[model samples]
Target: MPRTVPRLVSAIAALATVAVLAGCSTAPSRPLEGYAGEPKGVDAPASSAGGASWTAWLEDGTQFAIVLYGSSTCPPKVQNVAATADDTITATLAPAPGGICTHDIVPHTTVFSTPERITKTAEVKVVMPDTTLTLPTRQG
Candidate 1:
């Protein structure tokens, strides 16, 4: 009986380890669109309004990041973007996948490649849920 007990415990341990690994990879994360680095030139105006939504330039002026603060583990990200006008963009979020999320406020940045039709010379407006973030005019 003692020998069988040890073997059963070992088997349970192995199963638990496999379950953890599978759980980590099962849920989808926000796919990376481009480099998330901060741009050196003219960029978006930063604000903590509502302490949640914000925007920043990335990869010079070719890309930008829409940031939302919430659970660090399951942070919400911009799933889709389309230019509604020359200086305006419409943003949407993906359906929140079910998973354990850390109870902490951290920035989840979703990078996006700037569309060709979007004007870079004027104030760019990103229309998001409950807010509209504005980016300053791009400078040389």
Candidate 2:
């Protein structure tokens, strides 16, 4: 009985340790300000029938802003900061994490034109990874 008591106590202790460890584990947290860098130059891409899309890769920051201008009929472009890739116009974007980011703007479905073309220009700002590369509007 004495030996059985010690084994039972040991088992209980092991279970408790496992539970505590499990509880300590959590999903990795994404930092908002962890990315800190500069904005890089901008470039342009070939025009597409659907429309144009702009992308700016951050050089050393976690957030970035992109200004997109469309035709007079389209909505006015504005600047926005991104926390996650989903925060941008496209959810699939993978902005470089940790002090580097990318900004991409795609035309919404509301765009209407026989051969839709963005009449205006796009401005991009990147932050993080310590390098900035701007490509001009490319077809979406």
Q: What are the TM-scores, per candidate, against the unseen true structure?
A: 0.65, 0.23
Q: Residue 56 of model 1: what lDDT? A: 68
RMSD to the hidden true structure, all candidates: 15.9, 16.8
Ten contiguous residues minimizing lDDT sum, candidate 1: 34-43
Which ranges in model 1 have alpha carbons more than 4 Å from their true place? 1-46
Candidate 2, poorest ten consecutive residues by summed lDDT: 109-118
Global lDDT for candidate 1?
0.70
User: Model 2, 73: alpha-carbon shift in Å?
Assistant: 11
Residue 137: error of model 1 in Å?
Answer: 0.7
**Model 2: how far is 81 from its true place, Å?**
4.1
Which has the greatest TM-score?
1
RMSD of 1: 15.9
